[model samples]
Target chain A: MKPAQFDYADPRSVEDAVALLQQHGADAKILAGGQSLVPLLNMRLARPAVIIDVGKLRDLDYIRDDGDALVIGALTTQRSVERSELVAREHPLLAATTRYIAHPQIRNRGTFGGSIAHADPAAECPALAVALDMQITVVGPGGARVIAAADFFVTYLTTSLEQDEILTDVRVPKLTPGTGWSIQEVARRHGDFAMAGAICTLTLERGRCAAARIALFGVGAVPVRAPEAEQTIIGQEPNAALFEEAGARASAEISEPLADIHGSSEFRRHLAGVMTQRALTEAFSRAEAR
Target chain B: MTAKRDVSLTVNGVAYSASVEPRMTLVDLLRGELGLTGTHVGCEHGVCGACTILLNGQAVRSCIMLAVQADGAELMTVEGLSEDGQLHPIQQAFVGQRGLQCGFCTPGFLMSVYELLQHNPAPGDDEIKEALGGELCRCTGYQSILRSVRDAAARLRGEVPAAATEGEA
Candidate 1:
């Protein structure tokens, strides 16, 4: 299959790319790693009039530790983040999550920001962003502004980003020194989109859960935060019963979940609870280890 | 009509330049424009690894990559595996181990295994499986393919001979 015809532009600078987008408006599509966009283009699902190839923008390819957070440029490949010693040492959750994005070859070309900007509910990076409370920066005709991950994603394959805006970087805070994190997902096959997934980070203080972040993907239009579940576990000791209760609450709170050939609504809800339980258990164990 | 873009890339150590449509994928450019048909096309989407190639020393799916994106990049396709009319060690191992049935996915597997062996000369069974998992082979039940990779690793490391053993075939 071949992609539909589109005008191509290779921008050397972020400002040039944003200007191109502004000129074309919604008719333009930003090409980053092309792992996701190329497939969409080849399938003719995305028929953009113009494609702005920002993959060559060296200015946007970097990973730096800025005090409390790791600021990753939008053009940084997923493989680079996975192999980064800094990421492995500080943001182990991000490192573990990148491994689950896709097969090795795909990860070699797929970019960190592209995955988040694509906003696939089943994708690991977006879910991790939501779960970890990462900050996203976007540049447009208006100016550069930082948006919280919670506000960035509006729905599946849709984000709050404007047509003229280009995602510049993502800032993911390093995990707390004593916190435990786990990413668990269920996919029909390896490298396939997750049928249901859960990302959890837990901080235990004096034998009680001081802070917990629970997020579910493949269960809603957007990656869903389980506030009820988080509320259930905070200040409570981590235990089998508490974890099960939190998981059930997390699943129950999602009023509507996606359903298709992959799974039925009921099955997805059930899987969400199971995945959440598994993530919590694993995360608790890691907390103990820490 | 879309404007054609001029792309110059080195494929298998041979530099070639072509003016392809902006929408033309690298796999199409390789097979149609450059006549490098050793790379197969399957699923045209990125799922199938039939069109896998080495783009600047990393194995990537060419079907999803545009030819223009590879401008000035060094690429290695399946055709690059052999020299002087002799099969590459990986190819020889595949044949000796009966790793292929239809031989459609061999190029991609070879390229993938090529990179794997470069990084790790002696990968364990799980590592081998993980690397090959990116590419799909409809035949051989995967056991022989696994054996072939192990054999290739041994041969590449000089732990085993390069020639096929006697099978009375």
Candidate 2:
């Protein structure tokens, strides 16, 4: 399963990497951690004319605490995020979600920005990005621009990023005070892609839900935000019954759920509901504890 | 055909330089060119951890990483585990614990365990399982492998004598 022959370029800087992208357009693929892309290359599913290796862009490998937000470089490995004490203290949901990724071996090399840019429907990074409303920054010939996480992912393996743009960094806002979050997924194996998953955040004001965010993955073309389900939880006091209704709404909201050997469309739809219910239940308890 | 690129890296404590195709994976370079065949190849994709190795002290799937990408990096393969023709404590623990049947997945497991024990000398069972979650073993049902890791951790932590775990291999 060797990769097909392809020219390679090691770009030292972000501008140089963007220039190469501009030169090759879509014919070239950016090689960040190469956790996902390299496998596709090995199987010849992805035969890029050129591979622009951005591994040497050391500047884009960092985790910075920027007051209200955590600015993570696109090249920051998932393992780094998993081990970051700042993330553990400030954004526990992010820290916990990072562990739900493949495994330590893959996480050691998989870049944060690469996962978000790859936009795998079953991946936790994109769903977490959407659930937290993270901001993604991409650099191109026209300089850098930021895209809301909601607008970042367009479809399966596709993002709003232009052909010549390289995702530079992601800005994850710290969890609001009294906000509690949970991520839950069911995979065939511990490290396999989830069959279906849910990520939710709850903020309780007084005795009612003041803010609620819910996102589902592995059941659609992209990680989807369940606004209808979220609306069900926002104004109501969260209980097991309320969570069940919201889960049903979230499941119903999915117009098309992906089906494969792993699970049927109906099974995934059912799992989406179950996962949403479980995540909401856990989040509610955590919010109450806070 | 793509033009070959020059790559220089240190593997198993020795420096090596080679010219390889850009599409060549690090595992291929290690096994085919460098002759470190201890790092077996079960799946060329990243799913199987047969080609796992240490790159700059981090366990990674070498099959999914390009050889050129490993340029100027320090690496450790399964072949590097033993010292002075002596089996490493982890390998001894595997031998003692019967952690293998076919032995094809052992090398990847050993490298992964090496990294794990290096980071956490006293990892609990859950920690060991999480660290080894990527590796796939068809034989032994992973129970023996888990025992081997626990034994290896004790051996490394100086709680158990390495000689006491020596088995007839």
Candidate 3:
């Protein structure tokens, strides 16, 4: 079925694109890769008066090493992120988690910033972003400002981005060498949205965890980092007992689980604990093996 | 308050231009305006990979992309998989290997396999399965397609292995 009629604008530059957004505001939706927004439009779930096609703005598709982090342009496709030698080596968790986004075809068109801006709680990227404590750069009528990943997702499919702002780039810090990383999810199929997913990253020094980050998706309205879980493993050796306690903490912290055709809230809450335990166990083993 | 945009795009090595409402999907523009009907559209919401196409050398769901989003990008449809009336190696393997039954899923399968081979010149069996997992086929299980991708990979490397038929896994 055809989507409801809407206006389209292909801006040549990011500046011009955000200007169009400034002009149209609530009636305008920025188009990055169209991997998500287009489906929403066709379903009539979204009917913006203006569709700003930013694919022509090639300048926004890039990844650069920014000393402490990798500054990825908003239009960078998940395929690029997942396959980049730099990302795979330095940010293995992002690269490993990105493979779970959909499939090669969808990943080729799905952008990193687009997924973060879309803020799908069930999506893996956003949860990784929150886990990594990345920073998002948003350009709007008032000029550019940064928002931490923790502040980005306000709710399910809802973000802190204002109507007139375009998410320009996402800055993700890289993991130093000898760090352990693992990500896993349970989905009905390989490319289906995850029923529940967990990303675990821990840095070890002298056989003890120096820092740990745990993020979850498809378990709540927004992908949430389990602070209690993070606290449990930090400064300690990751073991079966620690992992079990952290999983229980995560299951306890999830405010209200998300329910859909995939699974119920109760089911996801149960899965959150299971996945957390699995991811933690695997990541810890990798860390200890080396 | 519909807005119209003029977008000139190159499709399957042919240049075309069309002015369409922003609502026009890449699938619509390919079929309705440019007459590239080979890019099939099944699930408009993108769960199905029938509308998959090579957008700037990457496989993407055309149905989920606005036509204007594809402006100035190179595109390849199922129609582009042949050269001078000769089937591409992968396409030949599909036919020679009996990879299709009812054929609604053939276009998507062909495009996806093309991408997989291009990305991994000699992919392992697990890699091949991961690449094809996104596609859903109602016309019998994809046992044949799995064979076709591996066979095509060998043929692309100038090795003609005997077709791995039934119970050959």
Candidate 4:
């Protein structure tokens, strides 16, 4: 399938891209990597009147260690993130989770910011962003503003970003020392989108869970942060039974689990619980080893 | 119709220039305009890896990328694997290993393997599988393809003579 005829512009700078977005507004679509958008275009599902190609904005392709966090540019390809030594040393969770994305071919063209902006609930990037409390920066005609990961995702395939705004970068805080993390998902194939997934980070103090964060995706419109599940684990010694209880809490917290031809809502809920349990179990062992 | 844009790029060591519409995919430009039909179009959407090729030495799905995106990039296609009517070592390995049945998915596999070998001259089985994970092969159940890549790796690493693999075919 061929895409519908559309006017194209490859802006060289972020300011020029923002101006184009401000000009075309909702009628234009930003083409970064085009791993996801091009497929939609070929299918005629996204027929934007204008396409703003930001591929020329080389300034937006970087991975910087900003002391407390890693600042990744919007145009940074997933392949770069996967292979970054800084990411592997500082945030191994990011490197491990990125491998769950489609494959090398797609990762070579898919941008880290594009995945976050696309906000696909089944995607690993958004779930990891929510779990780690990452910050997203968006640039508009007014200037740039940072949005909390919790406020960034609005719903399925939707973000809080305005039509005239372009996501510039994301700030991922480094994991505190002695913190253990795991990202687990159940997908039809190794590279396919997950049916349901869970991301967990655990910090243990004196053999007791000091802090726990749990996030679930592919079961809701947005990545669901399991506060109740985290509460169940905090201040308690992690055991298989405790992990089971937290998993149940996480599954029960999903208000609206998505259902499709791949799996029913109930099945996804079950999978979310199973994934959380597995992730927590693994995270706890790693934390104890730390 | 959208206005056509001029693009000039190097493919398989040859420089080419062409005018393409903004919506025309890189695969379309290669097949229809440049007449490089080695890169087949399976799923125009990015799902199938049949349109895979090397852009700037990295393997990518050409079907999802616009022709204008390759304006200044160097590319490699399946047709570029051979030189002076001789099969490349990778192609020879695939033939020896019987990596294909219908052969429609061979070009994509070859391009992907070429990139994998270029980066990792001695990749393990898991590494090979990971590199080719996106490609879908309905025939041969991928076992033979896996063997072919392993053989290709050995051939490229000089562990196996190219003629030895070709003789096995």
Candidate 5:
């Protein structure tokens, strides 16, 4: 089906894009990879009056290693991120999960910032950001501010970003050398939105769990952080029992999981437990090795 | 009201300028305006890779892109898969390995395989499968298509990548 009529502007610079957004406010939508926004527009799920195409902003697409942090430009496409040598060498989990975002064609066009900005609870990048505790830089009329990953998601389709603000970049710190990460998701098809997914990263010291974080998607309005599960692994050994306990806590801490055509709430909760346990076990093993 | 934007876009190495409505999709412009019908439109959304084409040496969904958005951008269509009247190695592999049944989905598959081979001169079977997973073709079970990609990768690398074998029809 054809999309509703709209005005299109190809802004030559980031400032041009920002000015356009300032003039139009919420009536305008920033077009990046268009993997998410375009589909919504086509289906009339979104009816923006203006579309500011910022895909051509070359300055906004780079992956650089700035000392201790891996800074990714907001417009860096998924393909670029997945193929980044720095990302793969340092934060391989981010690169690995980037490979699973949609599919090859979409990844080639979809941007890292766009996916995070879209803030789909079922999206991989958001869960990745939450799991890794990345920082987002947002620029608006009031200048720019760095937003922490934990505070980024306000609600479903809601973010702390203001209307005139554009996400300029994301800074993700390197995982400690011994840290291990696992991202697992189940979708009806490979490229379809996930039914339920979990991303877990663990750091072990002397074979004891030093730190563990679990971020879940498709289990809540916004991607949920499994706090109770994280608490379970703080002082426990990286053993099967600890994994099982953390998994149970993960499922228990959830008041409700999303129920839709793909799965029941009960099934999602079950999958959460199963995937979290699997991920935690895998992560712990990786931590113990090398 | 503003007039339709006058934009010039280069498609398949040929350049042309046209006045297009701001809302016109790049797929429509390629098929309707420029008269290059290789880019297919399925779902009219990004979910389906049927409208995939190489934009500036990278694959992107034309359905989500406005013709104006692709202005002055280099694009390669399925029709441009050959050079000097010779079939691209990927196309030859698809033909040799029987990657098509109905052929409606063939163009997209070819473009995706071309991309995979470009980035990875030699891709393993799993890598080929991952690259082609985005496109869906019902008539031909993915077995033949996957083989075609492997064969194409072999041919592109100037060394055999995978055997062109079929276990089932």
Candidate 6:
């Protein structure tokens, strides 16, 4: 069960890492935390001719507060972000969602940008990013460019990043005042991938929903934003009926959800509505408290 | 295929250098090259925690991490838990609490609890369960493991007599 033979290089700088990726193109794999990629390598699911080890790229591992968003370096471990007081205070939804990732050991070695870049449809971060309208930063041979979360995920286990690109960071905008957020998922076990999950965030102005964002995962090829669901509840008084209607709309919007041994498409579709309803109710309650 | 790379790492506070293949996992390095076979390899993927070890003081799956990745790094396998033949409090607590049955997964559980007690010496039942959830154990039904962690925490905090952990009684 050893990984396939491959050349390994620990790039000292981000630019050097990007340069290596450009040179190797499709033959090189970038190593961040190696929580996801190493497993793939062992399984021969991925057999890159070369591996660019970014583990020692200390510059890429950080969490900083920008004026408008929390800029997280790509190498930041999930456990560090989960235990970060700043993330907890400013982005409680992210902090909470991070705890559900895998387990303490996995999180200690899993990186934020790696998860986002992996773009697992059942993963929590992608769905949360879509709901929060986060930006994914990628550096390539051409230059640095920003890709919106919506555009970054192209399909299941595939992303919009070119073969020569490396996802460097993510920009999670700070929630505006009086905004509440929640991510709800129904995984069989505590740390398992959710069968159905929803991320809901809403800003309330004087007891009415001023803005809302709804996104669902584990129900489609890619994490989906429920525009109709968001439209149904925006600018309306938050209530059980409104939440239920929004959830129903989300369930209706997504088409042909994945079916596997985990759960049936019908079950996931049903759980989507249920999870969306619970997420909205919790998010509204939090907003009310704010 | 890439040539073997020379890697020097500190394992259990002892510095050792070896030339390892790039594909050799850290667990294989510990078991095959250095002969520290206490760290078990279960699942060979990241899912099973049998290969868990302290990489820079954080629990990580050694099976999935490359040996070359640990170059110039510090690692602690389950063998490093005790000092001078004395069982570490966690290991002693495992024996005292009957935390092992088949004993295959004990090393992983020990390292995990070692980390938990290092960070939070007074973890509640829920916290203990959450931390232990990372590894799988088919034996002991976990209640004994929970008790073992609590005992380990108490021993570390000086709440229990040191002689009690020495298996004297």
Best by lDDT: 2
TM per candidate comes to 0.97, 0.98, 0.95, 0.97, 0.95, 0.96
**Model 6 lDDT, full chain set:** 0.89
**TM-score of candidate 5 to 2 decimals:** 0.95
- The DockQ scores of all candidates, in the order shown, are 0.77, 0.87, 0.77, 0.85, 0.64, 0.74
Give me the runs in candidate 2 sitting further than 4 Å from their true place: B161-169
Name the weakest run of 10 consecutive residues (lDDT summed) in model 1 chain B.
B160-169
Best by DockQ: 2
lDDT of 4: 0.92
- For A1-290, candidate 5 gives per-residue lDDT tens digits of 67788888888887788899999999999998887887788788998999888878889999999887899999999999888888888778888898779888988888999999999999999988898889999988777899998999988888998889899899988788778889888898777788888999999888778899899998888888999999999878777888898899998888778998889999999888888999998888888884
Q: Which 10-residue window of candidate 2 chain A scores lowest in summed lDDT?
A: A173-182
Tell me the tens digit of each residue's lDDT in model 1 across B1-169. Answer: 9788899999989999999988999999999999999999999889879899999999999999999999999999999999999999899899998888898988889999998999999999988877777899887668878888989999898886545635632
Tens digits of lDDT, candidate 2, A1-290: 88888889998999999899999998999999999999999999999999999999999999999999999999999999999988888889999999999999999999999999999999999999999899999999999999999999998899999999999999998878778889999999888999999999999999799999999999999999999999999979889999999999999999889999999999999999999999999999999999
Candidate 1 backbone collisions, by pair: none
Candidate 4 Cα errors over 4 Å, as ranges: B161-169
lDDT of 1 at A135: 96
Report the number of clashing residue pairs per model: 0, 0, 0, 0, 0, 0
Q: Which 10-residue window in model 3 chain A sums to the lowest lDDT?
A: A88-97
lDDT of 2 by residue, B1-169 (tens): 7899999999999999999999999999999999989998988888889899999999999999999999999999988889999999999999888888799999999999999999899999899999999999987678878888998988888776444333532
CAPRI docking class of candidate 4:
high
Cα lDDT tens digits for candidate 1, A1-290: 78999999999988899899989998999998899999999999999999999978977889999999999999999999988999998888999998888888899899999999999988999999999899999998878999999999998799999999999999999888769999999987677889999999999888899999999999888898999999999999899999999999988998788899999999999999989999999999999999
What stretches of model 1 exceed 4 Å from their correct place? B161-169
Candidates in order: C-alpha RMSD to true structure: 1.6, 1.7, 2.1, 1.8, 2.1, 2.4
iRMSD value for model 3: 1.4
lDDT of 6 by residue, A1-290 (tens): 66778998888987898889878888898888888889999999999899999888888889998977899999999999999998988888889999989889999989999999988999998998898889999998778999999899999989999988889899999889999988899987778788999999989999999999998999998999999999999999999999999999989888878899999999999999999999999999999998
For candidate 1, the docking band is: medium
lDDT of each: 0.91, 0.93, 0.86, 0.92, 0.86, 0.89
Q: For residues B35-55, what per-residue lDDT tens digits would candidate 5 score against the true structure?
A: 999889887887667888998
Candidate closer to the true structure by lDDT (higher is better), 1 or 5 = 1
